[model samples]
Target chain A: MNKQPEKYQVFEKENEILRHSKDVLASPELLSAQAWQQEYERLAQSYAQLLGEVKLLTSVSDRLQNKLNKANENIARKNEELTQTLEMLTRERIGKRATTIVLILAAFFFIVSELVIDPQLQQSAKIFGASGLIVLKVTVAIALKPIEMILENLLLKTAVRKKMS
Target chain B: MENFFLEETSKTPKLSFDVSTGKFLMSGRSIPENSIEFYKPLFEWLDEYVKKPCPKTTFDIKLEYFNTSSSKCLVEIFRRLEKIKDAEIVINWFYEEDDEDMQESGEDFRELIDIPIVMHMIAN
Candidate 1:
């Protein structure tokens, strides 16, 4: 039954005014053109931000494409170099294989001729004279030794050169 | 002068120089193990030919590829041709249209040599 406080009354009146102001602000008739202008400005700023993002994405895409092209060119050049190198290596390997086969055949013939044919020839030459037989053997040994040494030296030189290269 | 003819190997080009026809052709790949041995006699022959230079000398170069050594030999051949006096030298450099490297190589040779070089781009 006591009288309400003055502070409470004043607070109630302030709340009522705030509520009325909010309603007025919400009303279309109370809204000024400046408010719409501000809203439009905000929307324009957001659009500008989105446009900037799109521009950045485009630039990034262009850079990526350029990098991809460079990578492709590098890969192609590497492939070409590899192919040429492989071809050269194969040619050299085949040449070496052929040379090895020839050398093996030559050695096989040399051994057969020296061990079997030369001894038989020397025995047949004994029918002529011991001097002739000894001379034939000496001649064959001298020729074969020099030839063998020469071949060995050539092979050694070739091997050394190959290793150095 | 005797004609120069060398059979082509897997890694070397065919070289045929006809003295009567004045036609010289070098075709195929060139990556010889001994470039000096392969090219020494060729240069000597060209040197001798320059003494009795023909009225028209046509060189047909249709190389698919070459290494650095072979490139040096090619330069030597071009220089030999450049030394000829009172002789018309015609060099036909043939390459595939899509071979950018060969095109650039032709351009490089053209810049290095002072001779009439015709670059022909053929489709492979």
Candidate 2:
């Protein structure tokens, strides 16, 4: 890893201390115990500063890890939900199928009654009058969607019975 | 039976299931009030197609949104395709970048179906 700028500053300070070694060791009288104690204190302070920076970086790293964990957890939860939803959908076609069967069958029944069954009945009742055709048309119109829905329910019941067997 | 093709609408997806090249595709929104009714023709066509399938059938699916009812129909479509024994059924599910829901939906579908499904991410 690349050296941090603060670490580089510490290295420069150490190099400066090495350069002044002659002064430091030359005369104990000029550079006495008091001066030596001051040099020791400066090095100690630098070490403490470096320790603080390390602690800060480690804390930031920990926070990022926590965020990553939370994101992963959210994704896992969503996946579970999706699985459950898919299973439900895969099993739900019967209900929709019943509705579709009704719609198409209803349309078919309507057309047959109007064009086939009703006309035949109308022809048989021609002696009564053309009013029979009008009545048949009215009844077919009133029962169109409802009768289809009823037939659809019947079909659904039969399907359920078959499946149970 | 002739190949099926239904144009996309605001409430439904575009459906084009051809037989010549064996390319089945459905794209866009699918929120029809009666999804089963809308998909009835597709099922009828597939029933015929599976009888004499092509070497490789690629089903491309790209849906921006779909309702719960449509989900069931889609499942039915996949189940129908699963009956084919010869043709290689490949499903390609496409989604825009950062669309996690769509991607996961595709994942869910692939898990339930026997066919191979590949997910593709496009630019958002």
Candidate 3:
């Protein structure tokens, strides 16, 4: 009996078939007519079974591949969603910090204007009216929004750069 | 006979075969680098078990995914189990509700193996 390569054999039955085929090929005249017919029938049966097994394996393997592909897609989508959410949260946090910083600066300017600038203006012969002082405070208040926006954008860019690095 | 057990890993499934209860389970994913090497002991254990199998044997298989080589090993496992003519063997094939591929794979195994295979849907 010729020893077939183990790597090429999927099952013992397949190995047996290969051995039988080798033996028949080596001595074709030794097999009687009935034995030859029996061998043919057995080969046919094994072929049918092998064909069925191959079909089933192919179908199952294809399905598994599809499943894995879908799972990979799902993971990618979820990762994208998580990254977006984190970015939104980071933006919100930076925006709040910027707003708080602007508010504190605004308060300091108000106090300095009340204590120092107001007395200077009161003594200066009223070159500018009280409404001018009101307009100055209003302008500072109006600048607060843009200042906060600039600070938020700067912080966000820094954060993105740090992450990339 | 002693029970055969293997812990589940990232790339392989969990395998547990109890001799006392005749309950076998293979769960999780099976995409090992070498499936035959991984499943060799289980096949040997089954070969010994069939000789003195319990009156009623039940095998529960709940695999989310398996590679082509692993599928061939699975077929070999089922064929070995089909040899237990003296015992009442049943295979419970579990699949996730949304996993039509797994369900159909189980159905395909049912068509090939003689042992009674019952399809079960795991609720999402």
lDDT of each: 0.72, 0.73, 0.88
- Cα lDDT for residue A92, candidate 1: 64
Q: What share of the true interface contacts does each candidate keep?
A: 0.00, 0.00, 0.50
**Top-lDDT candidate index:** 3
**Order of quality (TM-score):** 3, 1, 2
- Residue A24, candidate 3: Cα error in Å is 3.1
Q: How would you encode candidate 3's per-residue C-alpha lDDT over A78-105 as one tens digit per residue?
A: 9999999999999999898888988898
- Tell me how far candidate 2 lies from the true structure as C-alpha RMSD in angstroms: 27.7
Q: What is the lDDT of residue A162 in candidate 2?
A: 76
State in Å the error of residue B57, model 1: 0.1
TM-score of each: 0.44, 0.43, 0.84
Cα lDDT of model 1 by residue, B43-88, tens digit: 8899999889778999999987776556656766886898998988
Candidate 3 global CA lDDT score? 0.88
| lDDT by residue (tens digit), candidate 2, B66-123 | 7655665676688689998966889999988976667767777776677899999988
Q: Write one digit per residue (lDDT tens) for candidate 2, span A1-165.
A: 244353233233344654565466666667667888997687676566445434533443444455468779999999999988865664466556766776787788888877888767877787767786678667766775676567656765776587679
Tell me the tens digit of each residue's lDDT in model 1 across A4-104: 45323322323454465556557857568997677557556655634543453344344445556877999999999998897677556655655665567
TM-score result, candidate 3? 0.84
